[model samples]
Target chain A: MELILSIAIGTLTASGVWLLLRPRTFQVIIGLSLLSYAVNLFIFGMGRLRMDAAPILEGAGSDPANYADPVPQALVLTAIVIGFAMTALFLVVLLAARGLTGTDHVDGRER
Target chain B: MGALFDHLIAVPILLPLLAGALMVIVDDRRRPFKIAVNLVSTLTLLIVAITLLMIAGGMTASGDPARTSVYLLGNWPAPFAITLVLDRLSALMLVLTSVLAVAALIFSLARWHRAGPHFHTLFQFLLVGINGAFLTGDLFNLFVFFEVMLAASYGLVLHGSGTARVRAGLHYIAINLSASLLFLIGVALIYGVTGTLNMADLAARVGDASAENRVILEAGAAILGIAFLVKSGMWPLGFWLPTAYTAAAAPVAAIFAIMSKVGVYVVLRLSLLVFGPEAGDSAGFGAHWILVGGMVTIGFGMIGVLASQGLSRIAGYSVLVSSGTLLAVIGYGTAPVISGALYYLVSSTLTISAFFLLIELVERARDAGADVLAVTMEAFGEDEAEDAEEEVGVTIPFTLAVLGASFAGIALLLAGLPPLSGFLAKFAMIHGMFNPTGLGDGLPIGAGTWVLVALLIVSGLAALIAMTRSGISIFWASIERTVPSVRVIEVLPVLGLLGLCLAMTLQGGAVIRYMDETAASLSEPAGYIESVLTAERVARAPSGTPDPAQGADEETEVAP
Candidate 1:
């Protein structure tokens, strides 16, 4: 399971980076979104691949090691939300740039 | 009062946040009320900053190295909830931010506040993020505050609607967004290995990690440092800075000066706190790279300065030079150089900010068509009768005289000329570099140190040439110039900032003493670790259980 997850993350990140190097702003935005997803998954996997384990403890006395680590889950959740907001912001700015420059190239012109 | 003092560390982050939220709801048409709110909150921030500085100073003066004020949010214990720790370093950054924010806020009052819908709200939010970044003692919270700072900055950078600003803002946002993703990855890697994200706890754990874990930790730190280096405007990664900063409106650019230093501040804080001498095998992981990168950044910035045609771009590159000097000096990791770097940091930030603000006022009256043509001509090394007719004026206008004098002050300060704090700061660094005490030696300086010293002096000279060329072009070269109708509001902020720089020059002794103490405290992380880790340790002692959830909502009372 760990190996499969690692490979998946690697693939996502590699493709995202490749797309990020594209010239078009739309491709760059998609690339950033892909990269963010990979990062979110990576953060989620930091808790060491829990199987059927609870993130929340029912009682005050439950051992922490018995449950899935909640911190990474929280962190990944925050990352996902922030990533969404950032994507929205980037899309708006890209549209504005496209409107003003009459091109969608990241550098504002097609070479 | 005692309770207020106990909670004072949280106020810097909270005050701006609350005021910003309030400003969002206040009708934009209520301009006076919005202005009143911004003024009151910023002034209050200044007061709180002065108080925090005094508290930090008193703590340092009491000779107790472990006397840091750690505030736990949501009534949680250390390593469990978010903690805000105020040591000498953080307190100093808070004061610096407040001071710069006050100046920028006043300068913006001239016309910039009316530019957009949520200008005041965004400014306050920017402060919230900056203060929070400085004070947060946890890595994830640092990232959160970093996002806050970046988000607010994106808004401010695009505050005024212009084609140049939007284009540059897109690049700025893209670069920073990628950097933020790297920051997340780095944090995740570190958290995966150590099972902790509290900075103090991480510092403790990093020393005891297994070899494999240590390797991962170092990789994470390197990646994290890249994120900061991008923000710090280190040579290659900071190509977007000149364009973005030059294109932004004046007040935003001035406040953005401190924005780059936020990266420097993080690098200094984390490098020392988490990976300092006490980190065993990882004592000085990236010091050499920082030195090399900083030197190259200085070289790049110098070239950029000399090649820059516009005064705004020159000021932008000067920011890069300032970052390079601080980073390079910091890379040395010596107490004396660090102290001097701290002094240089304060003086240069103030001067560069004043210079950015002054550029607009000085260049406002020049004919844009002729100015651009002249710049293009100068760019091609043509120095003939392009504007020779207008250069025959004898009497300088009053506003022109004030501007010329201010320009001269800025040039002297940026170039590190004699009789100013800039010169003093650079001299102290060189002196400390050559004569670092306790090195047991014939000569303590190395080849790398010599290279840094040479770069420092050469960069100063480069700044001198660039400033002289640009100053002549703007003030002296032009003939058909209308005397810029400067307002008192705008002129006062520049004078106030310059006066502060002069004051730093006059009181170099006391300021250097403070910086020396701050640097000394920074060099030893044991005190920071002990203070933070021990804060909530005692509160959980009576329970005698290592239960992570015990103090989830308990306000662990700090001992006075």
Candidate 2:
């Protein structure tokens, strides 16, 4: 499970960084989305890749070892919400830049 | 009164938040009403900030130098809860942010607020974010506040939308978005290694981490430092700052003067609190890189200042110089030097912000064509005829005179010349470097110290030269320019900010003493950790076991 997740994260980050370096605004936005996806997964993995464990306490005095740590899941949830908002904001800004500058290039000018 | 004071730490975050939400519901067409709401909220924030400062200062002066007032959100226990810790440093930053907000909001009243939709709302939300970032003691909460701040900043930067603003805003958002991703990864890595997100608890656990865990922790810290360095406008990572800042509207640009400092503040806080001497294996981790990066940033800023053509761009580069100085000084890592850096932070922020405000007014006198023509004439040595034809002893308009005087004051302050807070800040810093322990005798001054001193002096000289050149072209050579119709409201904020710098110069001793104590408290993290981790949850009535669902609802009710 760890191996699969790590490889997934690495591929997503590598692709995201490559696309981020592209000059087009749309590509950059997509790149940011990919990067955020990778980050979300990474944060999720921080809880140590638990399977078949309750995320919350079953009852008082229950063994915590049988429960998955919920903090990283909560963190990932917040990161996803923030990431969604940021991507939305970036899309609007990208559209605005394209409309105002008459170019989709990141620099807002043709080479 | 005492109970109210306990919750004062939360007010700075909540007040602006409520105001922003309220403004969102108000009709944007009711501009005056919206302005009134913003003004009231900002003024109240200033009052709260000042009261907090006084409380913090009083605490520092009394028995406990490192005493902190912690407010637990949702009445949760310290490590499990989001806490707001108000010590001398956070209080000082809160006051600074409020002061700048007041000036910027007042200045925006002239014209910029009407340039875009939802300006007042965005402004209020920005304050909420900045205040929250300063007050929150949890890392995750800090990230949330940072996002809030950045989100609002994006809207404000693109507020008065133009091709320039949109283009600059594109780069700004992309860079910051990437930085935010880095922040998340770094934070998660640290959490995976340490099992805690509360800063004080993290600090405690960091000291006892195994060697392998220490390596991961340090790596996390370094990544986190990079994220902050990007925000702080450190060398290489901060190339986006000048263009974006120059493109922002005047008031927006002015408020952004504190934005970079947020990064610096976090760096200072974490370096001292988490990785200070108590952290066994990782003591002083990454200090060398910070020092070297800061010096290079100073060099870069000096060149950028010299090369910048527009006054606003120079102001932007000046922000870099200010950030570089503070970072370098903080990296030096002595109590007295850190105190001086704190003073420098205040003085430089005020001066740079005032300069940003002054640039718009000053640029008003010369039209765009004339600005280009003047630069061309100077470049081609064709200004002699204009100089010869200029009339002698032309009476300067009162507005022009005031603008020119303020321009000179900003120049002197930026250049670290005598009789201004800038010079005094540098003087205090140098004095501290010479006497690190307040004793006449200390370790011999090192070569790195000499290099930093030289850089500070040279950076000041570069600023003086750049300002003089820009001033001559705008005020001296542009004699044929019409005086821009200036409003009293517009000019007052600029003068007020400059006057505050002058006040800082006059009250140097008291301010320095305050900074000295603040730095002393920062150098010792034991009290900070003790106060934070030991803060008990609020006591409740003894009853039968409550429903978990009801308990969750109660937590939400107690929030704010």
Candidate 3:
């Protein structure tokens, strides 16, 4: 499970970085979204790969090691929401840039 | 009253937040009402900040021995929940942020506020984020506040939308978004390694990390440092800063003078608290990088200042130079140098903010092409026709005189000339570096100290040259300039900021004492950690006595 998750993160990050370096504004926006997804997954994986382990405590004095760590899950949720908002904001700004500068390049001019 | 004071630790974050939300419900068309709300809220914040500063500095009658206060969210114990820790350093930053906000808010009242929709809301929210960033004790909470700050900054940067602003805002958003991602990864990695997200807890645990975990922990810290350095406008990562700051509206840019410092503030706080001398294998983990990065940033900023064409860009690059000096001094990592760095931080932030506000007003008097025309005329000799009507000993207009004088004051401040707080700050910093172990210790200074001293002097000289060249063009050389009709509202903020700088200079002894205490507290994080970790939960109503099983259920319920 860790191997698959790590591979997924690495692939997402690599593609994101590639797209991030592209000149087009759309590419950059997509790259940011992909990178955010990779980050969210990485955060989720930070709690360690656990299958079938309940995230909540069973009762008082229950051993916490039996439960999957819920903190990273919470963190990933917050990251996803923030990432969504950022992506939306970035899209609006990209459209504005395109309309105003009459170009889709990140620099706002045709190179 | 004492109980109320206990909650005041949260007000800097909450007041602006509630005010921002309240402003959202008010119709944006009612500019007067919004302005009144903003002014009242910001003024209240200033009072609150001063009170917090007093409390943190132990000036209050009810002073605690630790001189630190922690406000746990939901009245929970410290490590289990998010906390807002208020100490001398955070209190000082709060006061500085509020001061700059008041000035920027007042300046925006003149004309810039009308350029965009929901300007007041964005401005207030920006405060919420900055104040929250200063107060948050949780790493994830810091990330959240950072996003809040960046979100509002994006809107504010694009507030007075122009082609240049949009372009610059695009890059700013893209870079910051990437940095935010880095921040997240770093936080996650640190959490995975340390098993705690709370800063105090992390600090306690960081020292005890297994050898294998220590490497990962250091990597996480290093990554986090990169994120902060980018925000702080350290050289390579901060290439987007000058352009974005230059393109931002004057008031927005003024407030942003503190924004870069936010990065510096976090780096300083975390480096000292989490990775200080106590952090076993990780003690001083990234200090050398910060020192070298800062000096390089200083060199880059000097070049940018000298090479920039516009006053605003010069102001932007000056921000970098200031940040570089602070970072370098922080990297030096002695309590005394840190004290002087704190002083330098406050002085340079105010000066650069005043310079940014002053730049807009100064540029208002000259044509957009005045710089180009001035340069061409300098390159090719002045036209005979233009020289024919050159007036001898002409009297400067009242407005021009005031603007020029303010410009000169800012120039002196930025260039670290004598008789201003800037010079005093640098002098204190150099003195601290020389006498790291107090007077007469005669400790041999390292080669790095010499490099830093040289960089500080050279950066100041660069600022002097840049300001003089631009000042000559704007104030003296322009032939067809009309005196801009400046309003009292706009000018008051600039003067108020400058006056504060003057006050800092005049009251240097007291202020330096405060900064010295703040630095001493920062260097030894024991009190901070104790206050944060052992902060007591507020007592609940007697009727709320709960069973342990029920309490456990409630905890699980709230966990997600």
TM-score of chain B of each: 0.90, 0.92, 0.93
> Fraction of native Cα contacts kept in each candidate?
0.74, 0.84, 0.84
Task: Evaluate every candidate with DockQ and list the scores.
Answer: 0.61, 0.63, 0.73
How many residue pairs clash per model? 1, 0, 0
Better of 2 and 3 by TM-score: 3
Question: Alpha-carbon error at B46 in model 1, in Å?
Answer: 0.8
Tens-digit lDDT string for candidate 3 (A31-83): 99889989999999889989899887764688988899999998999999999
Instruction: Please provide, for model 1 over B271-386, each residue's C-alpha lDDT reduced to its tens digit, 9 standing for 90 to 100.
Output: 88888987889898898888889999999999999999889999999999999999888888899899999999999999989998898788667665335324433433232364
Off by over 4 Å in 1: B59-66, B369-397, B438-444, B536-560
lDDT of 3 by residue, B1-560 (tens): 37888889889888889989999999977878999999999999999999888888888766555378889877777887689999999999999999999999998876678667899999999999999999999999999999999999999998767678899999999999999999999999999998899999998888899999999999998998899999999988999999999988889999999999999999999999999888998898889999999999999999999999988889989999999999988898999899989999999999999999888888866677345333333533334354434323233358888888889999899999999999999999999999988797988888999999999999999999999999888888867768876777788899999999999999999999999999998988887888899998777656767644457688876775
**Residue B283 Cα positional deviation in candidate 3, in Å, after optimal superposition:** 0.8
Taken over the whole model, the C-alpha lDDT of each candidate is 0.87, 0.89, 0.89
lDDT tens digits, residue span B178-288, model 2: 999999999998999999999999988888999888888899999989999999999989999999999888899999999999999999999999988998989888888
Q: Count steric clashes of candidate 2.
A: 0
Worst 10 residues of 2 chain B by lDDT: B387-396
Best by DockQ: 3
User: Model 2 clash pairs?
Assistant: none
